[model samples]
Target: MLVGTIMRKIKSRTWKKQRYFKLQDDCMTIWYKSKKLFPSLICVPLFPVSVSDVEAIREGHQSEVLLSIADEFPADRCFTLVFRGRRGNLDLVAESAEEAQSWIRGIRKLMENLENMGQRERLDQWIGDWFRKADKNNDGRMNFREHHARLFSFFQMADRSQSGTLEDDEFVLFYKMLTQREDVLRVFQQFSLDGQTLSQSDLEDFLRDGQLEGDNVQQHAETLIQRYEPSDTAKLLNAMTFDGFLMYLGSSEGSIFNPRWREIFQDMSQPLCHYFISSSHNTYLMEDQLRGQSSVEGYIRALSRGCRCVEVDCWDGANGEPIVYHGHTFTSRILFKDVVTAVGNYAFKVSEYPVILSMENHCSVEQQRVMARHLNQILGNKLLKSTLDGKAAVGLPSPEDLKGKILLKAKKLGGLEESFSGTADDSQTGEVSSGKSPPSYNLKDYSRLCLCVRLLVSYLNNIVFESPHSQKLTFISPVFLFPQKSKQRLSKELSDCVVYCKSVHFSNFKHSHIHSKFYEVASFTESKARRHLRDTGGEFVHHNCRQLTRVYPSGFRTDSSNFNPQEMWNAGCQIVALNFQTAGEGMDLNDGMFRQNGGCGYVLKPGFMREAEKTFDPETPQKRDGYQPVALTIQVISGQQLPKVNIKEDSIVDPLVRVEIYGVPLDQNRQETRYIDNNGFNPVWYDTLRFTVHAPELAMVRFVVEDYDKTSKNDFVGQYALPLRCMQQGYRHIHLLSKDGTSIPPSSLFVHIRITELE
Candidate 1:
């Protein structure tokens, strides 16, 4: 412990064998602690890891029970710590009731504080905490000089077969214990000479011949001596040494995350519009657009999934405050204040990126005032009240600069007026000029006409209306600019709120190659998006890069079914708004895409999508200049925890594996795995499936395990999908998860992945 820093000590504790100890979020230091002592037991970090709940526990005695790891341990006495990202529970026991209560309060406080932190701060803190707690000795450094015996013990504990070596799945599990990064794993695979297992001799040769990269060559050399080239040969490693383990951890080879790229400076430097934002449509509804309940949980759920943009439809409420719900429908109603509070509190919990509050307002002046007040009070400093430099920016601020801020994007009184300025102003100037216009309407009427009057309470808010793109609080409210003979006269009566956006009913792919700002925010339904994807995908890619486009569910989707977001993401549309309550392939793909880049909800678009001047035709395949075609091979070996679907018969499921390869060129994607029969519990097929693909970077492999049925459709069992880029080259275990993004305990698919470059 640091000298000045203070930590409360528990009064008493039971210890069978203590290894490591530390208090941190997402990870407990037990893994490293055991590595320092003996590597018999440790808790693994779950995927999309999170610390769910913390509560106090007590018994009849003064001591408090924090956890019950043993089966016979009393459940009534322990405080449970529920965590996700891995299978099973990770509970830590506290000594006294006071200690348990203190731990619970501290953990809750951190979780509550997550909302208040800026996006960059939260990510930075999380990364730093992972590294600090991983340094099990608490000596501010990690070294393996004295822990080689324990490292051997660690290797031995995982070598279940006593084959005297660790192969594929065992290797992955062991490497995961060291670091969760895939980049490091790729480099580690280069040392496997036999193309299967890493034996004691291979490890020994690696220790002697491996070249150490980066500063501190002497320390690395000393580490090698303590392990392989020990002065006393009798102390030579039985397996791998602690010094070798520490060398790997300290080397550039074992980076947990990108050491240079994990900071805010690297991610936050791009324009807000440049990022592909994770957004939600009808955020208040839990199930359907009509009958679902409108509550705070919807907002919480959306934000927790890394959604950076959320829609809120507001109207007049019973009390003085405004209310949120679907208009003219049976959907339940909730307070507008409640939604704002929810957004402000949970916005940064999943991602630290800026949140765009897209509000559709239909409220009286009194309720509008109430909304303004609640936004200002509840959100406080988190609300983006002004531009960063206290002056109007030429363009919108970078996402990095707007970190931890809530931007209200609503149709304002006087908004951005670009090429189609107000009639009076345009007529007086004879063109789109930077000059100001006089008040053409009554002031009282202006206040009543504008629902967001208090937020954008000035005539200057009409800059975007006069021009095209406006940097005023990242506001976006596209309107159809229809040409008319009396258009100039009609525009004058409307005053400064001369909306932008030229409506183009895209029946054909014409008028795409043109220079434009965010003047035309094209909106499309799911069917329309898919139509464009099939007919003219290249056109959509070019169109989405230059300007922002939104794709929502079609009107026929009365039940609010969501379309596959990956199809839209492939074309680079930023706002692929889906119904959050719906769970299926569409939502599953959405969850998978945004899980990267610290789950901040905003991912920097690929190089082709970000370059507005450059054109990348989706119709044209990506360049294969130095690349060769790849043949993917997977062996359906065995499965665990195959769920029983036939309850009436009370019989186990006859599970079969269907392996699919989704490639960049649509024609190359296909399913190849054959079905297995009659076995559900530990079924082994040993069947191999193969497919050929051109682009590995733009490909994904999905493993779906389902129960075979002759009379009806195959019942859904469990599924797993991941990018082909991160897949292991040899035998590996594919863990299964339900549609709700939770791990199904013991449900795993053991497979061998073989990738051969087609010459």
Candidate 2:
């Protein structure tokens, strides 16, 4: 296929220009260039997007900006490339339908290859990417200057005959020097008879002794030799070369995350309250909470990343419409209708599980009604307006029963029986009259208004018939209570949309256990949730098993920073909401937690957390039943192709690795390796770190690489995080990610992991 073509780039309605787009020969990067007066300027780059970075390819003007220009551009010729994480989408318009199809098909094929790439293939690609970056002149060779200072010694050593440049065999020698791992070499030589290559028996011994492979060690060794042996002669002899040995250790077979857990292996049939949901707080804001831009892009980003619950703070807008924003804050606003549309489009694009629209409604009754109409119309059947079954059940429905559905989590008023029984009307009338009633209204008028409100709700209920008569339905009414009332009156139309997760004020665990239904949900600020966890963690865990709980960040975090979600998760809180807009350790932990279970937005809670009989408190993990602690030993061996912390030409990082264990308070700990001065490339550590995890199932292990400094805190380079239970035991490669959780390819740590159960 032709790798390059001209396409019109669409940034906005008025910004559309022809640009040359090219897929590099590596098949991993797509580079584009705008026409310039000088040829030199044309060669200057905008940016190159990696094929693996693309989350999805949306066709036919799926993005808002693209859809806005539909009248000018042909729908068949327009498409959007949605990048992973928080990166903006790339919208382009082809000159012809054929060209658009060709580009789309070609990119899809490349993406498929990326997805199916084996361990060795991925390593080779990573190496090729590094070589390409170092080959500054693009001449298929690297000169001494392009090798950088950290590698200058290796470059000089590999450049035989004082050529000042390396090519072919010479380049291979340089690569070997660049990637040499003394730690792995020492282990390899210890097992090899010739101190060169390992025979099948020798490999088996290493697998049995070093990797702790129990049964069928010989078969596993043979498979590794066959699959990873780069030299054909060694493969024929049932032996593995050092290159092949390293390849095997870097492959998926050597990954820290267990391959079995990579799939959806957990039981997903449990009730919604029993699972930990990936949720977002202030999801509409792209930056800080105080003055951030509110855009529909936020909804798309969160949903596409497998966030099952998103906050939408609705406030009254012009023309009786509702706007979503951080209420009373300086943040910008987006139409509530647009948010609904975005959610409806992208909710099921990544995961088939149900999504919760966590509504923080501050809109007036009129605008609230508009919000309800928009959700009902835009979402259509995707909206869950009633319970799944005709009859009310003892517990909330499972995620399996609510697939592809969107549930509203908002305040609801009195139940249908009470609303139509005259009791509710009398109470509402008295409440309205007892408070500061409007001057135009008399006692008779107040009574009549309350009656009319009840009749209107009953008539709407009869027409919609959202649920069967067997169920006790609760619908919110638009009739506003007087100024003295603490809470805003909810619109019945919007309230009817909330079927499973009815938002309720939380008083105490005892009160909730007595009065709250399975469908009732309570939200807590970080401060309040922390207080509960600190004082009565067992009760908090018990409360979460029956009723859903959402823990959000404190309001004082005006910068939209996130709190550690692991704390809430420790309490079995189903919806631990975080500021998805920010990228830090908090968000990294959030991303790591949700990266498992096939990124399905719902992860089944640990068995102990789900069982009501077990009083497993995060504060006192050792008291839990069957609490078997685990001793985890990790040897930080080396780093490969570590990225520079800054863009300065002379910046040579003194890199260090820190391993952190996050779980119960008892298990939380961190240890670090001594810094390697002036070495970011192939820096060797071989430092061993250990931890005792009290709750392995709830623990997460994080590997962080930072550039050490003498006068200040270390600068972050990259890190990788995953549940400790998913961590594999063996020599493995920890692929590092940037602060934003995007892959920093070729930048990884080589480590050995051993986990032993302690009695």
Candidate 3:
């Protein structure tokens, strides 16, 4: 079919008609095609998009063609598509399922093609667009003297010794913010001798010609110095003047989304425990864990968001094949084979890193063969049948070594003796220790992977030993049923298989300590996590520095509300599992953290976290050498496309901007701008907010736009959050995102910021 043959944009909530939608081979175009025909009102382009950006596309109750934006996880049926730093997104609808399917298929094919080709040209176009936006003088190039006065304004944060130049580590930190790709960083570092630090000459050389050689490099460097070097400084010894460093970073090539970060250069050779792996609990359920419909889309959403670990509950079905769902609940069930098929297709599409298929087996012996056949047929080589290197290593393999592989984590049938030997018994061996539920037939040959797990996966109907509902692994629930919330003393059989995940309840952090190389992974509700964040945070940090922990929402959250994951991350806790169906500030922060390092869903722990020998307290952390409190000033000027608080209500909204500083002492961390009345389109506040924050590395600044409501709580419009250390001072455009994490394009807050020491 020809491109643009069938095009659509969702009807707006407040408007009678939406913009015109047209599909082309390379991109999608949305424009105002009015019947009155004076002229078109709007024309926007969404390009450089790929299959990875699509969260889901299926027939919806409201629209036949429902295309959900990937990763945004919009709460309702209608939400915008946000991807690749672009702003124009439409909550589109179509006439029929056939039409939507055709469009989805066509776009996916185009996305595949885009991946294979057109990257350089797309990057060039992106560069040109960004250059135009940053260039105030309309010149082809940016001048750092006046045009970039505020661009590198946060210079003090990274510049030590006041040398006006960032040394080796500082330069590397700067480049890491822009990109994590080694090749890109290598190219930028080549301009300097000994790679001590980058200078203006080095930057000018690389930006001007993308090379640092011949007389041309010096000529370009000199031209840049003449154009942007401070009117005062005469000459520098061998370093790039501050002007050149800032100017180069302001260019498109240095943009945070400059495609270099999309490269595969991250070091994945670290042990599995060394990185924070994205995971999802109840990965098959789309709503309440109790009674939600179980679909393969859950796996799709989690995996697409770089979630390396996904949960699957295998139960017997009426048919010969097995089914996946919350057992003995009102929740709907989906075919186990279908779930496996979906996993195989989408597992490595976003990230080539290893995937962990966390399985809870409960199928009958007859259906177990069907399950195995389905897994072997659908998953093919993607499934991990045996150890990658043929021989088992001493520790868990690195993600790099297991790339493009999927490892199954499930219980195997064994007695007290077999468990001691770490081998499977003939009694439905490879089958989980549950009653009667047979493990997959194909997997019967493989020895049971020893996994350390808690007594129950869930309090209500989780798989138990001997019986699936006894609440404990023993024959009865007396001796160990409520197992004193401490690390229950497990037999050698249970603790040995637990190479990675050693599940236990997180009652407190004091007793969870370990002197050996053992890792004990603890799970808790969000409320408990928050309590720890408030009360025993120091011990938690010390514990998480060496061990792993998993935090999920409380059972009381029937609607599946998520908590701000940053609170957990701040404590160095890994595996902060979220309910993939929910969207709020909590999920937004979750998406933000995993969005970096190529979204492989694994991020190496910070230096403090990797230091196993150190006892780093989160609250009373020993002040690092050469660190001081920063006096920060942020000016809130105005907002663009300040969307109306209520799209359905005609009443004009009074909007205000709230700037929050998150750092030590937690209290007194908030400041805001005065409200601007009746200016939903463009509010001008022009208010200044200031604060004293200790150590930029331990802090972050959050910007929130809200609609003032005296009778009720103020409603949130959008927000943006960035670590204080990564903030670039001067005049900056802070792009806003909805609570669900979708980008609110063209809707931005203009602000000026400066960071300096109080002295």
By lDDT, the best candidate is 2
Model 3 has an lDDT value of 0.57
Off by over 4 Å in 1: 1-268, 364-366, 391-396, 412-516, 519-521, 622-630, 645-649, 662-668, 694-696, 754-759
The model with the greatest TM-score is 2
What candidate 3 gets wrong by more than 4 Å, as runs, is 1-266, 360-377, 412-427, 430-522, 527-539, 622-632, 648-650, 661-668, 691-700, 755-759
User: lDDT of all predictions, in order shown?
Assistant: 0.56, 0.83, 0.57
Compose the digit string of candidate 1's lDDT tens values, residues 206-312: 43334323345445445544544222432353333333333343322332122233223236576665677888988988777767778676786788678998988
By lDDT, the candidates rank as 2, 3, 1
In each prediction, how many residue pairs overlap at the backbone (N, C-alpha, C within less than 3 A)?
A: 17, 1, 5
Using all chains and alpha carbons, the TM-scores for the candidates as numbered come to 0.58, 0.87, 0.60
Q: lDDT for model 1, on a 0 to 1 scale? A: 0.56
lDDT of 2 by residue, 24-75 (tens): 6666787777766234434344778888888788889788789789999989
Query: After TM-score superposition, what is the CA distance of residue 619 in candidate 2 from its true location, in Å?
Result: 2.0
As a TM-score, model 1 comes out at 0.58
**Per-residue alpha-carbon lDDT of candidate 3 for residues 1-759, written as tens digits (9 for 90 to 100):** 232332335533333343344453325322234333324423333333333355344433222113223222232323334343212234554445565566657656755654444323433333344334445554444433322222264445544456665444543343233322233234446665546444555655564444212356566566555544443443354355443443333342232232344444458897676677788877888787667868776787677778888878887788587889876566888889778877897799789888877666566556666776777678778876654565533455678988898765544232223433556343432322232222232221212221112233333244334475555432232323233332111222222233334343344555566332233355666787777877877677667766656777675576767776666776777778788777766666556556557778887766665666655445654443344567888878777556556744345668899987655454128888888877654567778988887645556567889999889999889887655655655445676787766664446676666777855
What is the Å distance of residue 636 in model 1 from its true position?
Answer: 3.2
